[model samples]
Target chain A: MIENLRDAVVDLVYLVCAVVIILGLKRLSSPRTARSGNKLVAAGLLVAVGVTLLDPHIHWRPANIAVMLIGTVVGAAGSIYLARVVPMTAMPQMVALFNGMGGATAALVAVAEFQRFVASGAVTAGERVSVAFGTTVGSVAFTGSVIAFLKLQELMTGRPVRFPLQIPLNVAVVAGIVAMWAWLLGFAGSSASVWIMFGLALLFGILLVLPVGGADMPVVISVLNSMTGLAAAAAGFVLENQILVVAGALVGASGSLLTILMSRAMNRSLANVLFGAYRTRAAG
Target chain B: MNQEFLLGLYVLILTIFLGFEVISRVPTLLHTPLMSGTNAIHGIVLLGGILVAGTAENPLTLLLGFLGCLFGAGNLFGGIVVTDRMLEMFKKKEPAARQA
Candidate 1:
């Protein structure tokens, strides 16, 4: 009874934070509230983080505490460095890099959880499905986001990189990843298949973004952000964390809406952003 | 299907409409800044990474978690700072500067 009450209290904390986050997003409709909105979201995040760490299930051992402390210090330092020095012109790529970071974290969580289940020898098929979804989408978002960053930074030309068999190759890679994912979910909990699936996903992300011109990066970035959010949400399900699930879903929704706004601003459609079929008609 | 899933779904759907309706009203000139500002919110994953790390005992899992936290923090801070800087540009200039 006491344990149940504790769980309820923790969840209640998460609920409050979630509401604050939504209110933060809603406040973004005007520039006047935008700064405060950012602060509100940050405060919500603090609450969420505080409660998650406080959960009794986490067992914050010496090593765990050590690791988190060092990571936070390192993370804080890097963030400050980037925020201080990176010019506004390079902002898109910076944003892409950040989105990619979120994806990588989600992918790592999925991978770590799967490893745990495998060690216990109780990995279920349903769990495999969630792992497959999380790994595939998260991997794609990570690599796709990196490519976007490179393009925006002018490390690569902005024009769509095409090859003699671009479409055929992309289709083949997609099929290969899907097949591997199915195998992992349906056959057995083989690490080999999972690795192959992850590799194919990385390849797919590169191929997917390679054919899009630089002018379409805002939409690309937002779409990729949305996918990353969905991936995180899937990871949350696999981990059974209420806060992760809600926050990830919220990001997914907001990212999608932001993508739509971006596409409209560009006077292009979603299909056009993804396929570049309407490139000339829309831009010229 | 499950209770947890149902709860997540409800939040997801509600957010979809709320996000769409709210952002739809912003002017186009502010679109880029708006997107940049929201970018920091995704850093919530940093907390998730820390949770994973907290439960994980092994070095490898811990390493991955550490890296994840690092990246998420970088993303979060970079996003907020950049957004703040961009929004500053939109401030109404001194009328004297405009005339001059």
Candidate 2:
């Protein structure tokens, strides 16, 4: 009975958090309510985190607790410092870096799970697929987001970096990675191959995002956000965590929608985001 | 101690924060763009959903993953559309100002 009550309480908290997120998003749609929206989001996140920690299933291992603490400190410090110091022109880059961090965290989580499976000899087919997808998608998001950050910050050139054989090179890399992933799926104990595939995907992501110009930062950011969601969902699958799965899915769907919307805002198509079709003369 | 208490606490805290936000008023310039930008961030949910959907063994999980993807896509697209309209209005004003 106690367990049931606890479960019910947790569910209620989750529902409340979800409502907060929705309300926050709505309020944030206009300048008049943006501040309130931000506050609502912060409150929602706090509630969600608190509830998660209270759950019995979440064993507060010393290492896990320590990691969470470190993450919180770093994240808080970074956000505070950036908000105070970053120029308006560089806001886009800051966003990219933060988004990249999320993707990297998800990727690392997926990689850790893969290591656990290898160490314990408890690998399952489903687990392998999840890890494989997570690693590739997460790596892609991480690298792509970093490149975007660099581009936005002008650390890298904003102009599309296209070579004579760039398209073919990109296609080849993608094909190779896909083939390797397929092989990894079929072969049970190919850890090295799996890592290699992830590396390739990372490279592909960089290559893919690098050729895009600054005018497309909005679209790039949106697309990368979607990638991060997908990465999180993949991580959820690897861990078999229901909350992670749901949260990840929500992020992914929302990110994709945002990406599409961003494209339309610029009078560009999704195809343009994929193929580097749009060109701004001023960018040159 | 109970869900009600927790919920009440949340509401109280939220109210305080909202009040402060309204007073500061610095984030006004950022309202529309930030909303559109952050909404795009939510699109990450789709990526997560896709990953989840691919790996989920159970039917329930798969369903949730799909839903996540759907909602995320909607947000992404909707945000962009709104932003586009806002930009168009700005562009129109530029031309009108030139004529004046």
Candidate 3:
């Protein structure tokens, strides 16, 4: 009875977090309520995380806690400084980098989950498909966002990094990704294959984003955000976790809308944003 | 096909519409801040990172989990903070400054 009650409480808490998150997103539509909405979303995350820490299945130890604590501190302090110190002109780059972090997390989870499967001998075909897909998308978001960040920061040129072979190279990388996906789904893929997929996807992300100039960055970042959300959603499918699914879906939805709105605001089409490198006049 | 997968699909379909409806009305001036805000929402994937990290035993798995937690935390903190900062600037209507 106690065990069932505890499980019920956990599930209920996750639902609460999910609802609060939705409310937060609803409030975020207007500028006036946006900060408070952020607070609400943060509150929901806090609750969800607090509850997760109490789960019996998690093997918490001092070392693990230490790792988490250090990460939290660095992330929190670094952002607090970014908010305070970084000028307004650089906001988009900061956003891109932060979005990349989310993608990296999803990719990391996919890898970790696969390692677990390898260890336990419980690997299933569907599970492999989801992991392979999630990790590829996640890797794309990670590397692509980094490239976006570099350009926005002026660490790299904001102009299209065009070369004669750019299109064909990108096509080949993408074809490689598709082939690897098939291999994984066919149950013939090994860990080596998964890593290869990850590398190729990252390369594909770079190739895709490299040719777009700075003027297209807002739309590019927003699209990447949607990709990260989809990767997270794929990760949820891999894990079969309800809260992960809900959270991922919420991000995916909002990110896609934002991408559309950003492109419209720039008066560019999706195809233009993706491939219109010949139009140098579009650079801001 | 499976029940859970179908349920997830249902959730996904509903949320996509919900997102479109909620975001369509936001003004252009607020677009940047709003994008930053949604960026924060996705940071909830940090929960997955924490879970994976906590359960990890092998060296590679542990390293991956640690990096995931780091990245996820960075996303959550940095995204919200930057959005709040951007929103703060938006609230300050300058009397004579040019657009951002």
List, residue by residue over A1-284, the lDDT tens digit for candidate 1.
Answer: 77677778888998898889878777765777876777787788767777777666676688888777788678768876876688868877877887887787777777777777788896776578767887888889899999999999999989888777777898899889878877887678587777788788888989989889998888998888888887777777777776667667777777788788779877888888888733544477
Clashes of each: 0, 33, 0
Order candidates by TM-score, high to low. 3, 1, 2
**Model 2 stretches with alpha carbons more than 4 Å out:** A1-12, A30-32, A55-64, A277-284, B1-100
Worst 10 residues of 3 chain A by lDDT: A275-284
Candidate with better TM-score, 2 vs 3: 3
| Per-residue lDDT value at A151 in model 1 | 94
> How close to the true structure is residue B15 of candidate 1, measured as C-alpha lDDT?
61
Candidate 3 per-residue lDDT, tens place, A134-177, comes to 89988898999999999999999999888877667887998899
* i-RMSD values for every candidate model: 2.0, 13.1, 1.8
At residue B15, candidate 2 shows an lDDT of 37
DockQ of each: 0.58, 0.06, 0.63
TM-score of chain B of each: 0.86, 0.62, 0.87
Misplaced by over 4 Å in model 3 are A1-5, A278-284, B1-3, B94-100
